[model samples]
Target: MLLTLAKEIGFSHAAAVDPSSLKAQQEVRELCAADRCGHYGRNWSCPPYAGELTAAQKQLARCTEGVLVQTTGNLADEFDIEGIGRLMQLHSRRFATLARQARLLYPKVLPLSAGPCTVCRHCTCPTRPCRFPQKRLSSMEAFGLMVGDVCRAAGLPYSDGSKTMTFTSCILIMQ
Candidate 1:
């Protein structure tokens, strides 16, 4: 039912995953520390503020399973920047809806997004408290998760091997 809802909400794909398969590795955290996306220490959903790696692992241990959701878009060329931006926006909105509904069904739902929280135009992170704490959804990277590894474990392809861009997110459920 949740998977169907995910599709209805506009995700390209959705699948179930075993919680045990999602591991929190220092290597992944190290990558996040690189701050390629530039949200590393700037947003509450990013690392440091996202919580310690141990805390993320502990939360993962409590989850029974998860649902991996993705939104994929074909690029016109190697530099289809506009297309990528559109897909990102669409995926973010869709994932937020899915996460919100999932929380309604299971209060303990943990939503790990593909990127930083987009609830605010500019996060009041390090400067002040998050204006919308209840709406902020942390990224999987923020939780020290390697999105590729999690997708592979879920029997889903992180990328379709096409000239496309894919954004992925997952909702962990405790039962």
Candidate 2:
């Protein structure tokens, strides 16, 4: 039922994961803190702004289960920036929709998305508080959760194969 619901909401793949065994790796957060993605200090959903890695760990500690969702896209080539961007956008949209649905079923659900929150074209961080605090999403890496490790722990494949790119996000559910 859950997997079907996830698919209907637009996720290409979905799986139940053990939240208790998930790890928040410091190295992942370190990469963000280094501003490698160019969104670390520029967005409200990234580190130093999203909240400390420890805080994310504490928040997920209360989650009893997790639903990992993925959207995979095929690129013409590894350097296909347009394809990559389009796929990421699609994944973000689907993840957000799935998060809203999960929130209805599990009120305390925390959604960790594939990238920075794109709910607004321009984030008002540093200048002002988040406009959609309720809908804002933190990236998996920002939360210090390594995508490959989480997927393996969930018995899901992180990569689909060559010429394919997969974006992963998770909804932490209390129930």
Candidate 1 on 1-175: residue-level lDDT in tens? 6787787897999999888887888887788889888888899988778888898889999998789999998999768999999999999989989988988888788989988999888998899999988878989888888899989988888997767999999998875
lDDT of 2: 0.84
Candidate 2 Cα misplacement greater than 4 A, ranges: none
Error of 2 at 1 (Å): 4.9
Weakest 10 consecutive residues of candidate 1 by summed lDDT: 1-10
Q: For residues 1-175, could you state the per-residue lDDT of candidate 2 as single tens digits?
A: 4566688987888998888977788999888888867888788998778877788788778888778999998999899999999999899888878887877876677888887888898999778989999888888888899999999988889999988899998888764
> How does model 1 fare in lDDT?
0.87
TM-score, predicted candidate 1 vs. hidden true structure: 0.95
Root-mean-square deviation per candidate: 1.1, 1.4
Model 1: runs farther than 4 Å from truth? Answer: none
